[model samples]
Target chain A: MTEAAGTAGPAGSAGAAGVDGPGRPGPRRGRVLEGLRAYGLIAAMWIRSTMAYRTSFVLMTVANFAMTVLDFVAILLMFSQVDALGGWSLAEVAFLYGVSGVSFGLADLAVGSMERLGRRVRDGTLDTLLVRPVPVLAQMAADRFALRRLGRVTQGVLVLVYALVLLDVDWTVAKVLLMPVMLLSGAGIFCAVFVAAAAFQFVAQDASEVANAFTYGGTTMLQYPPTVFAQDLVRGATFVVPLAFVNWLPAGYVLDRPFPLALPEWVAFTPPLVAVACCALAGLAWRAGLRSYRSTGS
Target chain B: MTDGDGAAAGGAAFIELDGVEKVFDVRRKTGFLKRERREVRAVDGLSFTVARGEMVGYIGPNGAGKSTTIKMLTGILTPSGGRLRVAGIDPSRERTRLAHRIGVVFGQRTTLWWDLPLIDSYRLMHRMYRIPDARYRENLDRCVELLQLAELLEVPVRQLSLGQRMRGDIAAALLHDPDVLYLDEPTIGLDVVSKAKVRGFLRDVNAERGTTVLLTTHDLQDIEQLCSRVMVIDHGRLMYDGPLAGLHEVGESERTLVVDLERELPPVEAPAPARVVRVEGPRQWLAFPASASAAGLVAAIAARYPLVDLSVREPDIEAVIAKMYAERASA
Candidate 1:
């Protein structure tokens, strides 16, 4: 029965269908472009869906902006009472806060919906993503693509501009260049933390809270100088989780302040390296998580 | 392609599985802070080859490995053992590549974005699959017309009925012109009209486009109407594989011959092995092997007894499958 049908089947139509034959190597650049296009398409669809309810979208964005502003206000209140925090002037600390806040906000904007990975895993939505021609991480990252989170990023940028005007610094060509690099690498580090933490959901299925502690908590800790925290805690953050590269170590260099742990100034220039290493490790964790995914029974 | 066994043999087997197994490590909490780990072989030593364009029914009891096999075929889950391929691509290894050629729909889940209009989902799929504009338009038009999705295009998926949502999903799967479609219970919760519509559309797709379909459904009529060949799986093993009629014979099933006799007189003398199993008033029912010829038995009954009317009822595929599972359990 199969042979009779096979004689009149998809062999001729396969070409007409425009599917690349098995193992046919399409141009690598073309494949990457296709993946990016798919990601952008999904992200746009989600943004449109969010905009469908205009009132709610506006209210949510405003509420997010208001809520994040309070975080910086608390820092302001702290400086009003004490002349400085951990022996750093209010401007220097504000610089660190702005750096951490902007990077975390950007990371949150990009991958915040990944916090729902555990729920997706439990509900089998992850399976739907796996069958798509696009990369799974790209799909997950763009799953809901919340635009409301941009409010936090906006707040961070405003605070950062405020600190840049307030601080008196000797800016070299390298220091000037390091400013954007620090923010981007800091965001990259936080993005990797989000992905790696969410990957654990494939096994535990309800560990989103555990992931939030690292992502949100790391940003909160980075806002204040590491000098305020105990030495051992600072060491763990630096060597283990590498949250220090996010802003603390680099901000010290930018402010020309002494290192908290009396570490070398050279260590302050390593955010990019740390970000790359964290991302590579996160990539492996995500791959391993996908391979270990036992999709829920139908 | 390096595993060149069947790829060289005319490429007949578009979907092939050889001793494919999926063993899940299920952990159970036996007590407080105590857990036990056990291996549950969802698919055990299963082997089957589906030639291109074959709309085969893959029926099995719940938790009998139907979904697991589909997951493995789609590369959602890797097989613990054995070789499996779809269109000569190792699914788990080149899942994204193979995904360009295969479309899958899970009845219990909607791949369409819930808050978006039905057409929006199709539009997203157009870019996601990188489908050619002309071909996407053609396939979309065909599916819309056949599945009666024109009215539901603008409606949000959350607002559509279950049947309407199901049609939308089927159309979404086809817009890319996939070479194969895996439908897990496509007719699951649909009304009679919707089921018929889906079955007709699938038949046309297979006949016209020659899209190989592996449908797993509980609705036996789905197989009766759409598939010429059916496979019955139980306990991760293929118990039966042949024409739907042959399934009854494998189960040793019997077809009932209900006869309305002229004032039932002592259970009309039926032929050997076709004895009356029940007699009520003037109606008498006889049991005959489903594989037997009912014409000869009907003739003998009419010749001797005053038979007013008679009808031969084909064995129920559902019952035949249940008996197949029962027999396997006992053996």
Candidate 2:
């Protein structure tokens, strides 16, 4: 049988004409575009799947929207008792809250499902993703994407609009351009944190709570003025986790407020740089985690 | 042998492993703050070469490294030492590239989306693999026709029976016309009819497309019907590699002969090397080497006893493998 198979190799090769050999690495831009296309395809399928249950989808979206609204209502009640919080007025605090909310919301919508990496690894689903032709990161990030996450983004935009109508600050061309930059860089930083924290699941399969402390906890802490926290906590947020880059420093410049810790004005322009560095570090962590992966027994 | 010799021999060796090894570190908590770390050699110094267009059966007992070998071939788990290659590409280094040329199906799990219809997963794969629209449609139509998936195409994967889901998974793996297919327990937990259908479809696929298949199965019938060459592994090492007929000779296996007499009588007086191993009332069973002819033994028993009915049973592959393992251990 082995001899017959060896003799039929040429005929087999002819039948497999449609199959390609090991593919050469394509150009960087082409690969990036291909990854994006694949991500879009997978995410669209998830959205359609979620939309299949109309009442459930609508109820979940409304519930999510209502829950986030009450979070802001707590701040309203706080202002009824006091004039300002940590030397920032109601509108300034609202601005901070809005920026952090929108940034975290966008990040969650994109890669929040990554928190289930521990479960995937334990259940052997990661092996399925590794065999696909697409990038594993893209496949994981787009898995089970829920469109209801847009609820939080809509609420954040509303609050930001209300704050813009109330606060009176001298707006400039740079500030106008900086608004979109801050939101995008903020989202980038949050996405990096989500991926980096999830990467630790490869080593400790049940350590999802440690990731939640950094992601959801960090967003909640960022909603208030940085001055309200301790000096050491603020320093750690600034240097170690870089959560301050999400909105605090950039919003300070936009609001023309004094820097917390007496920092220079140039610090506000560094959010983009900080976001890039954080994402690079997170990419490294993800790669290392993939290398160390010990798949479950079959 | 060196890779130079392998490559110089021919390109027929599509999948080659030269002393491939995979060792896992397992840490167990023995006491309070005292742990013991140990190395588990799941696949130790395994080597084999599978030629293209060969449908080979890889069978072994549990924890014998069958799944581990398939995982290494697909690049899901990298080997710790030695060399491995498929289509002249290192699986670990160029997994994504190699993925385009190989297809895999795990019967224990489904790659299809749980909430989506069967066709939806195939459509997602169409775009994910960037397969040409014409080729994708052709392959999907062929698989659906052969596997009888037309009635189940619109049903959500979660609602399908185990048999239906297995067929769905097999179709998903082949939509891209991959050069090689790795199936780990494809017909496990399946009914008799489902197993036959799957086997028939696989035979058609191999004969028509000439797709190379490496199957890991606990079901010996899956081997007898599909594969011509079989490799037996035990304790992370290859113990036997030859034709299925040769495995019986190596294990010194035996076939059973049952003889039913006219009435309750003593054990049948069988010939030498074919003694009655068991007797109940008028029925007696004689054991002989599987390689020997059962016709002469039947004649001898008929000549001595008043036989009413008689039958012969072939040796099962599991018993052959067990005997092989026991012989190695005792030696």
Candidate 3:
């Protein structure tokens, strides 16, 4: 192997980059761009691989679409018994559900591979990721991009459009701009939650259902108006987990509805801040998780 | 005995470890409510060095910290205590940086994407490692040719046979032209042909490319055929580190001399301590200590018996190591 290394060394030195020199820091911007490009290539490969099985891909997408639609149907059935619940109309509830759905779906598509980290760790495959130069999170995400989540995304968009058409809200530029912000930041929050769930595997040796209680259960709870829940539960979700920022708070501004619990109107626009905070916390948790994993490697 | 240029220039081993140790804290459930905690020292104060371009074999029985040492070398697991360096870089502190210089293959599980074609995994690695296009192409072409992977490149990794997949994995590890390659059981579960192919490629890559190799294997033949230097590890300790021939003497193994007598005869009266261990018609087998000179016994046998032909057999590595282990246990 050293003969190849000896020959390859001169070839590598002859190249423009001059091979990983110590303390050279080789163009930070270029490295970031290269990392992004590598991630893109990996993502493309994953898409191609998933596309290899067209029938399964389509079936999974359809199955995902049908499964989420049943939740919407259940909500509709509940509305059939009463004109409105929690002082919000059916369209208003759809608005909340739609936003949460779209954001969660997009986040699921982006970083859902975090859910499989526990399995990978258990099977000793995570060692492969650590060997790579790129960040393990990026590798895991790029390894499995869930295009099937488009099912939930499409349903969210359709429901959101229907709600916008049905409700006559005072459409303002600020409110319109906030829609994407809400969706993206909500997605950011969900992505952070997914990352946190993955980080737990390093601590617990396997992904725990406690993370699901916050992610899946939290998303299910977010689809409804916070007004319907007990004040304490609402407060906990607002302060403890901040799921309110993902849907409840933003829905108030989007629907031109009064803030629940007589909270300040400014709370309706704090999803981006909450999302950023969640991401920061998740990053810290992930780093600690990686440290523990390296030390113990359970 | 020929030191490669890298070791000559640097005047140091490419890999170095001093008093390395790895301890694991494990808790076991003894009963429904009882739990016990214990510290398992997987690697204990072990030390060895491999010069640049040296193909050294690391051999040990299961649970003897072979895999753990490899993991620590690759920075997948941090050592609990010791001084270690690969190419002057601390692996755990600068793992990603070190990744550019080192390549590793774990024979039991693949690093390649199982659902993707073999080439797809290589392509991803090309990007991931930031290999220059020309270099990537050159290395990929070389490995594909040498490993006979042209037909297997398009096959999904999951569909490849174990041997084919192992070959593909070896190629993948070398495609980046890493300075040092760590192979943990690279030929595990491989058939004879596949194993031979892998060994041949490994030899070429080491000799022609001057790439340093640290191979861990259970197959004694792997060590005998490829490694000029071999390290024997047991119970997380370096039991022996020397040439393959030295191991025979250390284990007190025996060399076999099969003598073909001119006719069917009683077991020839052999020299003391060189008595015949087996007899069949006209042939007799003599077992003598491997460290003893074969000339004295052969001359004595020839002077007394009508010997038509005789051949001396070197001690078997398997028996030597097994005896070594038994001796260690008894000691």
Candidate 4:
């Protein structure tokens, strides 16, 4: 494609301007379009390949749909064990679970490729992507989307909406907008964990499943008020590791409850900020892993 | 003019490699936790060139830097020290750009999408090279027809037999219609019929499209059938780089003669005109010196004993190459 651009220019003024002649105004635009070509290619392959196993695809989707109902089962089982162990009401805990369900499911749907990244690297499959003109991250991003994750996302949104109704707070446009931001923030946190796990695979050859502590454990921590957990361990994970951004701080902002850790209402924005930082770090770390792979030929 | 000026005098060579070397430090295992490190030179001080449309057969024993050199040429591995160019394009600096201009086929690897049908991979490659849609269709049709892959277009890659898979792979490489095609053992593991088909297709791709092809195959027939020039590498060094014909005529020990005799040889041997290679039932293998005539050897054998049949055979590539390597080693 770059070569074609070289030819696209005329002999008369070829060296003067790096432009592909005036007749074709889209030459520069074409270069940008080419990078996206690999993404489209992988997505199309993923769709066709996944659809081939029809029964398994449907079963997985159904299992995920059923998986959401387990949240209600947990709450009901817990309520029977005790009226309320923590000071918070059951409805507030349900609200936290709902927001987490929405964000985590969306993260799985959008960035699931990071989970299989170790296997791709081991098999030399990613080598093909490297040889192509596009950046490797873009190609990885384009591969595999789990539409079935809609079950969890939907369940989470429903519980969040119910919690909002029960609380009966005077909601404004800004407050309503904060919900989506937190949801996206939750996604960023999970994706960062995946990226970090994938990056570690370069050194270990196997993905660091410990990263799941931040993702799955982070989700669990989000389902309850942060005050219930001891300040040393859970508090440290929330403050230092920032799982609180996913639910605790954001929940405090939304529920109008006093947060165990002192912070401003601006804490609702923690999810997006931390998520972005994690993503950028993950991207840089992924690139560092790629360089290591090339040097080592592993 | 000096060598540099001389090259400039004749218009720069299509491809050039100057003293390329690659040394890798590998961790060698010692007892248990005590592992020693060693630096293994994969390629060293190698240099060669290919003019436009030249099909050079690169051959070497296993682990003798053949792969390392090819990787350097293809821009996969950066040579520790060298100046290299392919069609005036620096492969390493412009690796991604070079991808569009060249096609690569590793017999052990497949570039096609694993799960997608053959056509889908081709379509994806079409977008990759940005071959205009009409040109993509034209090239796709030509490659498909040439490779006899029209019937197999919808078939997934995993289902194709080794022969069929190789053919599909070659077609995939050409789908982008690259200027240079790097074929690393393109016909390995193929049956006689499939091997012939692959060789025929490659010859045509070179001749018809004027596409420069660099093929590395263990099958010497691949060389004799396709390449005009052969480059032999041994121990990370260029042993020989010239016409295939020149290799056979090394050092005047040329030609072999066979005499079929009806009667057995006498217990006491007579002075022979040529050295005998072997003597089997009704067959006498004789090596004729380049200085001597085959008829002289045959007539002398006939005078000494009754001969049923007589014929002369040009030394095969195996004998020539083996002899070449052996002689180069001792030298």
Best by DockQ: 3
Residue-by-residue lDDT tens digits, candidate 4, A93-204:
8778887877777876666676677777777666556555555565676667556677777778877777777776657776788888888888887777677667777766
lDDT by residue for model 3 (A1-298), tens: 1110001111222233323323434344443454466568778887888888999999999999999899799999999999898998999988988999899888888887777888888889888777776656666766687688889899888888888888898989989899999999999999999888889877776555777888888889988888899999988988888888898888897787887668898887889999999998987777678767877766
TM-score of each: 0.90, 0.92, 0.89, 0.82
lDDT of candidate 4 vs native? 0.71
Arranged by TM-score, best first:
2, 1, 3, 4
Where does candidate 3 chain B have its weakest 10-residue lDDT segment?
B1-10
lDDT of 1 by residue, B1-331 (tens): 3542224324898989999988888889999999999989889999999998999999998999998999999878778899998887767665666677799999999998888899999998887777889999999999999999999899988999998899899999999888789999999989999899899999999999999999999999999999999988877888888898888778888999999988957887777888889989999889999878999999998899888999988888898888877777788
Residue-level lDDT tens digits of model 4 in B140-210: 89878878988999988778889988999898888777778889999899999899989889999999887
* Residue B264 shift from truth in candidate 2, angstroms: 4.0
Q: What is the C-alpha lDDT of each candidate?
A: 0.84, 0.84, 0.82, 0.71
Docking class of 1: acceptable
lDDT: which is higher, 1 or 4? 1
Pairwise lDDT winner, candidates 1 and 3: 1
Per-prediction DockQ: 0.30, 0.30, 0.32, 0.23
Q: Identify the superior model by TM-score, candidate 1 or candidate 4.
A: 1
Separate clash counts for every candidate: 0, 0, 12, 0
Cα lDDT tens digits for candidate 1, A83-178: 988888888888988999899999998887888888998887788988887777778888899899999999999899999999999999878989
Alpha-carbon RMSD of each model: 5.4, 5.5, 5.5, 5.9
Query: Chain A vs. true chain A, TM-score per candidate?
Result: 0.88, 0.89, 0.87, 0.80
